[model samples]
Target: MPPPPRRRGSSRGKILDLIRTTGPISRVELAEMTGLTQATISTSVRELLRDGLVSETGRGESTGGKPRTSLEINPAARLGIGLHIGRDYTTYIVADLAGTVVGRLRVAGVGDSEPESAITRMAEDIEQLLDGLDVDRGAIVGVGIATPGPLDRDAGAIMGAPALGAWTGFPLAATLSEATGFTCTFDNDATAAAIGEFWLGATGGYNTYASVYMGAGIGVGIVIDGTIYHGKQANVGELGHITVDAMGPTCACGNVGCVELYAGPQAVIDAAHEAVEHGELDMEFTGRITADFDRIADLALNGDATASAIFARSAEYLAAGIVSMVNLIDVQLVVLAGSAFQTIGSLYARTIAQRLGERAFARAVQTVDVRMSVNGTDAAALGAATLVLQDRLSPRSLASITLA
Candidate 1:
């Protein structure tokens, strides 16, 4: 067998990332942006070109001499998979090297089911999706799984999470890899969404920012200098668990008056059900959290006072938590993502942005930009896939080996 290729340095990954984000770019431009020497950028980009990971799109305007050849990512050169496991639904996405989602699927979540059984079923779904797409298996980099967490990533295990307690200490990465015949990496959904946004250059070039993801729960993902900040135990962002009400009820995570207790999707759904029971809302709901949440949003949009009050209260609490986060981290950008925000994102966005504009400690010095994720409900799933792409194609360090 031929000897494995020598692994290149971090510079290669850095250059590739820049190309994907701001491509049809010249080698000179890369050198300028990265502050790497012209010689170094040439060497790294040459290796990327040789490996079929990058392509020279064409020439650009000449500065003084010969026209410069612009380079861009070869989107077809590689593929990645992202599996987002949420409270009520699971999503799968396939993205090419340029961070564009090529295929997607959604299915029932791990609600009241055995964690092991759920993983097995997801694995089969992945195989079938790939087969249906007729994707070149050899081009597949790997899979990244995003789940609600308070987990141990190095051990590839979930320590524990509410409603997902049965998955505690489960070897999620190993089990998924075993079932799918592909390498797997696991992380919390919020962090994955942040990475996905960063991978797609959605942060408007800010090196530090936070993604406030609302799904079954609320969580924050912090990225500083272009990397996810996995504070001790790889569980840094728990924005939902932050105490928003000192006199409120306790949460499953043992916190008092968490923002999620008042603002999460489940909270909204429960409140809607209570309103219906009390004859406040003259409507029937199917009890599915997402569907019910959407219905409430529609009613609110259509001028239902009760529904508007429910979401407004939720938005108020969520914005308060986010304002606190901004006060603490001072990030200039806060992105709203995940399934919960898919329908009522505008409400949350306006509230959060207003709170930040008015209350953030840095409000005088900087305006924190808050926007909805373009990926919508697919944000976490796409980010999960981006985890694989970033790891394999543009990792910050030398670790992964070239695929055979």
Candidate 2:
């Protein structure tokens, strides 16, 4: 049997993508924007119109002789799904081709659950959410799953996640595809969050950038030349496990004095709990660590010396990690994301910016921009959705799949 023919880019696809991103444009304008002839643009636009992907909304003002028709993408033409899997919860959302979320479902965490059980529950939840929506299932192009590292991108299995125990080596993408009967894409949560910011957040137009995700652990995703740089094994950006202090503390990844051990949410909670046990502060530490971090951030914001000191220590470790990243990658911007960053974001921003300005290798050449992610809690999930959109609509940059 002969191999199936390769799928190449079609003129219609290119024109449609242009209209989707920068639309309400006339045929002549599209030709000028894409460097295609007027006849080619007209034919592509006509095909898009016939497929219900583009529509003529109105008439544009005449540039020379007659008015031209304005073309725009029909956002209702297709849909995509994004799923963010964290230790505490699983977030599911449906978005249109334009990246507008139409539905959302947040399920309570699946802590310590076996991989199969957790994925089964997640698949059911996704099905229920999709069934409730009025849109046709055919409109859903694919699903994106974002989780912590280290991951085997080709095998679609999580190598090991500190928070999500018993998930290591599970065939996540294959299992989900079997259950849902739709193509699935899996990526590191931080990478997904970074790309999410580029597609839907405020980090656009920046050439080089880093997205720092602080959850149960720390992860960094780097973007250069508008493309994510995943090194060999798709785990190049494991910034959390980098050794910061040779004698600081033992990390879950078996490394001594890693940054995550000193600055992750667990570290903060451990410090707070120790303080509470020693008659320092009257507070509960047995509950959720994130809530505890939020409390600490609130107290610090309100001028509590103990809380302020704790956050300062955390920020210092985070700054050291940022300095290492800047020196190595030479990124121009760093964005903070996840719940932990949201709590003490301003402190992190100030501390990292100051340290980078003083110590970065490229400080004399270019200023490194550092700030918190505008997407906040929704970054990972939204980025997951973008994976689907890219797979279905934007094919040039999609990650190639390797079967097991």
Candidate 3:
């Protein structure tokens, strides 16, 4: 998603940017492509080569002159770790400079646990994960975390994530940094999913898209011109809390009619529990929400009408959210990601696509591509890893760019 269209500003940023976007190319080509003088290109390339960011990858065709040496990124030079602490599970991954995941691990169901205990365990896991890989500790850029948010990203503190109440006000990034001795960066899972999709996902080349992430809650990660829409505190992906029914139950965030209150997995489970309590539907439950949700999803998949209806009702609320998002953002693509979509994803995808086709404001001139993530449920974790790559490899301005 990076290597900006403009090649004149930030010479080193531009050179590395070109190498990333254009693939392996010679100094002559970089100079010609970026419109920078040969001397400037040479200087920048030398610094990059010395820093182990770029490598001479062989040779290129000789255009009536000597064959030029080709250069490309050294993917193994730098490594990054991305972690997502979800309600149902914790996913961790290590990626190299190319944003390719080289290692991964998972711990099931951590949202209800204490933040300090969960993080301490995760730090130990990182140490073990590092030992299995051949990369040096010095080459590690840092750790990137994607958790449910309304967090203070700069302060490394989490706030307002209802499921992570114990994590509220916890110094997440700083704590992880101190425990691991590597710098850490954090962002909401939704934005992280969008970043991962743009950089390493099949959603490549499509700069403007929305990634609807479902976990403990639902969020919309909006990407425009290859850049994520965010600020220092949090992001604009709280579309899950967008009001859909003014009369709906109040959310912990103090909003009534919030989409998550009606359509999130928890909402669906709560509805099912209510149905059971009222004797409207008969279904086995373990008194655990996670297990109950899984049971309901399996029943729906196996042709249980009641279970199917539950998902349908939830999808309706979610579609209302999609409609609002399209009307406001006018995006042509919407991707579904996160654990909530792990089972009945097709139902949501179908409902969203159908609704957009029927009612999206831009449907007349543009069609929305509503689809599920090809990366499966790991979109957020992989995207978390990309955060470190963007911060370490590309200049802040270039990695997230507005292209013409």
Candidate 4:
């Protein structure tokens, strides 16, 4: 037996989110954790079960009474599409409600290409990916796009980001939605990665953390008390633009000695080229940042002193920026994510941890937990997909209030 369909409310979303994040929970536990009455929990659970968003797993231990049924999210109930538009490549992934990547695709980036054509091509790529999956397209609630930041979230547009040339002021969300026939939403890549981590239960019991994402540039995503910290204009984490050296080269963002200029993928590529010119490293430049950076990373891994030094220097600079971020945010956990960290994630994690232990302002009070993303390089894309699920299933709100 199921309850009749009632008007959707914020309570239902919160209940569903709890099941997704901390599932196999009994109705009594839900009521206890949410501070909602048994009747309210029952009503919400019934609605969730009727909507096929949750399922009764099995009977739980009896507490001197009838066995309680545990509830969990139905991963197959709905799906979401996530796209990470990078300067070198675009990653597309389809995720279930559990934040699991069921399918994925990678395609050429939108380098100097017309935004309209690039977006249309990306839509086609998404169609190609969906066609290969054995799932109903209607089950997909929407698409979430993660790209370089300075985004106008309300307008669903990408501002004039340096790495994303020719995509300035483009109504990406609306256009992609029209092209793909699904509602689309957009956010900063770093923010999306952080949200994805949170949605996937990567933070464990910790409610506050920061996601440090490195792609073509460096960025940070802050999650405070289980919610993303989207400052004014939804562009809060521009860690790359933060000045690390007062006299270093100026960045496209007009900040001198910005961390990104020294630690981002482009910085690695530029440093590798310099090493090649100096006849120090014997690797041919591919002119493509991804390809060239891969070579440098390989050389560094293979004990090339100059190559390793380039990466080490970059890590040091990035560490300084992260130290500043941790000091300001006062978060305990920091997650390293993005394509740029794929080959050398552990190195960055180790370096950042060491630096934070020595330099963080709160070192005396608490040590910052530095680790790599569970989603690996696909974090941003997977996070983008989770954004769709979060938007449709877990609308953000303050603490859940007790139901009358």
Candidate 5:
């Protein structure tokens, strides 16, 4: 068997990162940006060019004398794969060095299947995707997996994700790595979303922010001091399970009146179904009412009294949850994200903003900024891909820190 690849940091890696982030620059500019000497930058660029990872794109216009050669990262030199493991489906995307997705594959409903079987299928799907693309295998750096929490990051296993029953204690990262022969990394879906927003969305400059991910369940990803806080055991941000009403409804986590029980998509659909069943409305909703929730939002937006009441109640619970979070963390910004938030996000944003203004303990000091996630359907997946990028480029050791 082939020996494991050597793991060593090199000047070429840092140079590649700099070029990928800010390219079309001269070696002198790179030296200035990286604090490396001009001779070192030229040496690293030569190695990168030899490896086909970078190239001299063109000559920069001369400022004083002869035009300097502009160095740029070869977008085709490397690829990163991002996989978002949702409750119902997995989304796979191949992104270039520039963070642009050039190829994609969607795998639907593998959550109910056995873990090994699902992983095997996922591996096959990835192979198929790679087979179809013209990208070189050597250029593929690694894969990133975004799964629902709570997860054991050290073990790379899913603990007890309700949406993915077959994934309990599954060694997802190792399985993918063994199957594909590539380095693999794992992160919580919500945290991945926040990183995605920072890396590719509008939250780059925001220091303290919260990414409220509303999917099969609600999860909040906190960014304090420009870094994601993954508290003890990678299970810190369980915003969905935050208690909103002591006597409300029972949640899947065996808690009563959790925020998710009131504001999650399932809860909204259940309310609508109950309303329909009790002759209060005439909309039939049986299984997985994603579309039905949108129908309720439309009705509320269109001035239907009953639907408006239901949405308002849900929004109230959502606001209460956000207010509680704000009082605890005092973050300046909150970004609403997830597939469910795509349609009715404005209603949630308005409710959360108003409640934060009125009731948060920090209201006297500062106002919490609530906004929608800039990346719509692809936030989680894109964030997952960014895990690979961060693992490779970012200075901090995300794996070593214990979140609060």
Candidate 6:
């Protein structure tokens, strides 16, 4: 919490950022990279070194000149904590300054506990994690919480959720802060995944894309030119509620035939179990929704008719949803990441690509790219960590620009 050396409007930010991306670089190389004079680069490097954010790696061979000192980011100088609260389990990760996940821990979820009790347990776990890792408390920049949403992020409260409404109207971030003694921030899981992708994963250089987060439910986080779009109260991208089948079942959101009713892994598992009960499905899958779906998807890939049809039905509905989404938003890229996508992701991706090719409004003029996240099931948690980084280094006041 100590005041960071003047960041905004300071050449040090730019210089430090460049060194991180293009390092073991020399002062001359940094100057060449930033178009800053050698003296300006020296001044910024001095500030960065004094702040302990940058360190000199051993000297490197020169290009027909004297050996030069190499510069690099001091990743271990600080840490960020990211937590993902979900129905299956909760994940907590600690990332260093350079976005490396240096440690992680998972524990039983809230179960039937109330929101206050659940958050209290999470706080304890975070304390244990830090203590076990022996991380300096001052080195922890802050904590970021990612959870299922319809959140009032600005107010740091949960609005609604799927089976998900245990904490509506609770001041989550503030309450957690009071308990843990660390500043806490919150974002819907889908949006957190997008920010994670923006900061530490694939979409770092890309300005616009959509990340579809499928866990117990489905949601999309939209980023345009490096800024996540948060409509009036941060309830913006509830993509699962889109009606893909007008004649399908009614949804809890008071909508008929919403895509999640068919494509959410829980929905598909329910459908699969129903098929099993009727003896239409040759195999039975039971366990966590994600595991059951993974088994079912494996059967489908192995050419079982029932399993294939089950995933196909889900994929068709998902395709309908994605096509509708791409048609409306026109983002050239859509990234699939979450616990659900860990299995059957390729099926969804292939089907979605095919759907976009055939049904997207501008298919003839443009192509939409569907990708799987490299961050995998950890995307939300990792992105949650990225939120702490973003808040500390790249404030919204510097919008529409690359984050630090």
Instruction: Find the candidate with the highest TM-score and give its number.
Output: 4
lDDT of 5 by residue, 1-404 (tens): 98444344455666776676677888888888778888888888888799777789899889998899998878777778888887566788887777778788876747467888888888888899889998888878788888778899888998888787678887899998998888898888888888777765466456788898887788988888755787656687889899988888787788888998888888888888788888886665536545577778788788877788888888899889888988898798999888778887888899999999999997898878888988776778877776786575433456432111
- Report clash pairs, candidate 4: none
> Which window of ten consecutive residues has the lowest lDDT sum in model 4?
395-404
The lDDT values for all models are 0.84, 0.80, 0.81, 0.86, 0.79, 0.80
lDDT (tens digit, per residue) of candidate 4 on 216-314: 888888887666777656788899999988988877887799998888888998898888898998988777787788889999999999999999999
lDDT of 6 by residue, 207-233 (tens): 678999988889898887656776655
Off by over 4 Å in 4: 1-9, 397-404
Q: Give per-residue CA lDDT, model 1, range 260-341, as digits (tens).
A: 9999988998898899899898667876777778888888889999999999999999999999998888898999998788
RMSD of each: 4.7, 3.9, 4.0, 5.1, 4.8, 4.3
Looking at model 2, report the run of 10 residues with the lowest lDDT sum: 395-404
On lDDT, the stronger of 1 and 2 is 1
Query: Estimated TM-score per prediction?
Result: 0.92, 0.89, 0.90, 0.94, 0.84, 0.86
* Candidate 5 deviation (Cα RMSD): 4.8
Model 3 residue 389 CA deviation in Å: 1.7
Question: In model 2, what is the error at residue 216, expressed in angstroms?
Answer: 1.4
Cα lDDT over the full model 6 = 0.80
The collision pairs in model 3 are 88-109
* Residue 343's lDDT in candidate 2: 64
Clash number for each model: 1, 0, 1, 0, 1, 0
lDDT of 2 by residue, 1-404 (tens): 98445355556666776787677888888889778888898887887788777789999888798899898878878777899888777888888767688888888767778878887898899999998889978778889988889999889988877887688888999999998888998888898888777766467568578899987788987888666776655686788899999887677788889988878788888888888788776666547666778887888888878878888999889899989999988898999998788767999999999999999988999888888888777778887887677656644434331100
Greater lDDT among 4 and 5 belongs to 4
CA shift of 221, model 5, Å: 2.0
RMSD of 2: 3.9
lDDT of 3 by residue, 1-404 (tens): 86336322367766876786677888988889878999999999999999998999998877888889999988888888999887667889898766688998887756578878887888998898888887778888888899888888657888868877888889989888898888888888998888787666467657678999987788878887656777546657797789998988788899998998888888888888887798766787775555677788998899977778999999998999999898988887899998778888999999999999999987889888988986567888888887777766655542243221
Error of 4 at 370 (Å): 0.7
Q: Where in model 5 is the C-alpha error above 4 Å?
A: 1-71, 247-250, 301-303, 364-367, 393-396, 400-404
